[model samples]
Target chain A: SQTIHQWPATLVQPVGSPLSLECTVEGTSNPNLYWYRQAAGRGLQLLFYSVGIGQISSEVPQNLSASRPQDRQFILSSKKLLLSDSGFYLCAWSTTLNYGYTFGSGTRLTVV
Target chain B: AQTVTQSQPEMSVQEAETVTLSCTYDTSENNYYLFWYKQPPSRQMILVIRQEAYKQQNATENRFSVNFQKAAKSFSLKISDSQLGDTAMYFCAFLGDSNYQLIWGAGTKLIIKP
Candidate 1:
């Protein structure tokens, strides 16, 4: 039984401001964590993924960056937010490559 | 590189009817996994069905089933006796052993009318 928690449920940030979205998994050890962004009417876009602590693989180059400081903790951050950065950010976890992912309730970011 | 495609952007079906959502993928890997995920208005994504490339039998879960054509690189999902609760965004994804990233398709919005 594993659960992923992502917050804050919704966020409103000013342009050029910093951003930090946190995701943590409970009830699983050494799980693979991922960060995805879904723009309106678009599919999920992979931003970053981590197989273990202190290991991060970025899928695309963007204004965002990810860090896995702990086994169950994955963080997505940005030093300067852009207007295009506004979207629904999701966090997901999976035990293996063959299985499906369990996603957390996404964070709606509105960069005005 | 692996890519998934869901052509239908939106579809509607009456309650109690059957609906099939089409999905096609392109991949060079012989061994991989395909999955269908459902995201309700609440935005909680859940796995509807999965098919392993090595298996010939199509995978089915309750009222949900998959038509896996490995050679054709097509994997479609069939929802039987659709309910209003079935209204959601359905996504197709592909995963291979070479990459941990799951390649996703542009989702199809399925609306089950009452």
Candidate 2:
């Protein structure tokens, strides 16, 4: 079975500080990885997705950026965090097109 | 562009009763996929059921099933014998066969009162 792991299940960052959230998948290779943010009482917003290493697509324009450093490792980063950046960040992976995504537990970010 | 909609904002059901959540989507693509995801209080998204556009027969899990109407663009989920653990926020999702992205609906909050 495949498993997705995210670091710092909960994070508290100061405004204007930098941010980095890591996601790595085990037991699968060349899987599609995605980054999503869910605001309180809102739908899941797709921030970025990577089909392969060094290939990334941004779904929405925001302060966050994504990178696929390794085949199974994906990273979401920001140089300067904003108050609006606070939300529950999730990382997901899929085997192929139109397949159901397996999401991680998620990282609750609180930017104060 | 594809869009998903969950008309119901919230629904309540008695324990052991059956409940259905409504969902509709808009898309121009002929080939696509529909999915239902569950998000518990923990906020973890879990796949509940999925239906392919080309399949005529409805998809069913142990206690969950989907009524897929391709022409109407409607896909609804029916949960049988609802359990307290089944209480969660349900989201409808649509994905184009050619794209790796998924469009999500706001979600329907389902509560099972015992």
Candidate 3:
């Protein structure tokens, strides 16, 4: 079975600080990876998606960026964080033809 | 562009009762997919059910079922004998056969009172 792992389950970062959240998937290769953010009571907002290594498509212009350094490893980073950047971040993966996405446990970021 | 819509912002039902959450979507393509995902307090996305546009029969998984109306563009989820654990935010999603991207709706929060 395939599984996704996201780390620093909960993060507290000071304003203007650097941010890095890592996500890795095991048991799958060449999977489509995505990054999503959810506000307190709002719907999920797709931030970025990667089809292959070094290939990323960003959905929104914001303080965050994503990279697929390795086939199974995806990272979300920011040079300087903003207060508005605080929210729950989720990483998901799906097969080339599959319609459903399998999501990781999510990282809760609190920028103070 | 495809769009998903969940009309109910919140719904509450007593334990052991039945509840149906409504979801509708708009798309120009004929072949696509529909899905329901559940997010609990832990914020983990769980797949509830899925329906393919080409299939005429609705999909069912144990106590969970989906009513797929392709012409109406409606796909509703029905939870039988709801439990407290069923309380969560449900999101409706649409995926076209050509694109790997999924369009999600603003979720409907379901609360099951015990």
Which lDDT values do the candidates have, in the order given? 0.94, 0.95, 0.94
lDDT per residue (tens digit) for residues A1-112 in model 1: 7889999989999999999999999999999999999998789999999999999999899999999999999999999999999999999999976888999999999999
Per-residue error for B28 in candidate 1, Å, reads 1.8
Enumerate the candidates' DockQ scores in order.
0.82, 0.86, 0.78
Q: How many steric overlaps are in each model, in order?
A: 0, 0, 0
Task: Write one digit per residue (lDDT tens) for candidate 3, span B16-68.
Answer: 99999999999999999999999998889999889999999999999999999
Residue range A1-112, candidate 3, lDDT tens digits: 8999999899999999999999999999999999999999888999999989999999999999999999999999999999999999999999855459999999999999
The runs of at least 3 residues in candidate 2 whose Cα sits more than 4 Å from the true structure, single-residue gaps closed, are none
Given candidate 2, what's the lDDT at residue A90?
Answer: 97
What does the lDDT read for residue B95 in candidate 1? 92
lDDT of 2 by residue, B2-114 (tens): 88999999999999999999999999998899999999999999999999999999999999999999999999999999999999999999999888888899999999999
- Predicted candidate 1 versus true structure: per-residue lDDT over B1-114, tens digit per residue: 678999999999999999999999999999999999999987878888888999999999999999999989999999999999999999999998677889999999999988
Model 2, position A57: C-alpha lDDT score: 96
TM-score of chain B of each: 0.98, 0.98, 0.99
Per-residue lDDT of candidate 2, residues A4-37 (tens digit): 9998899999999999999999999999999999
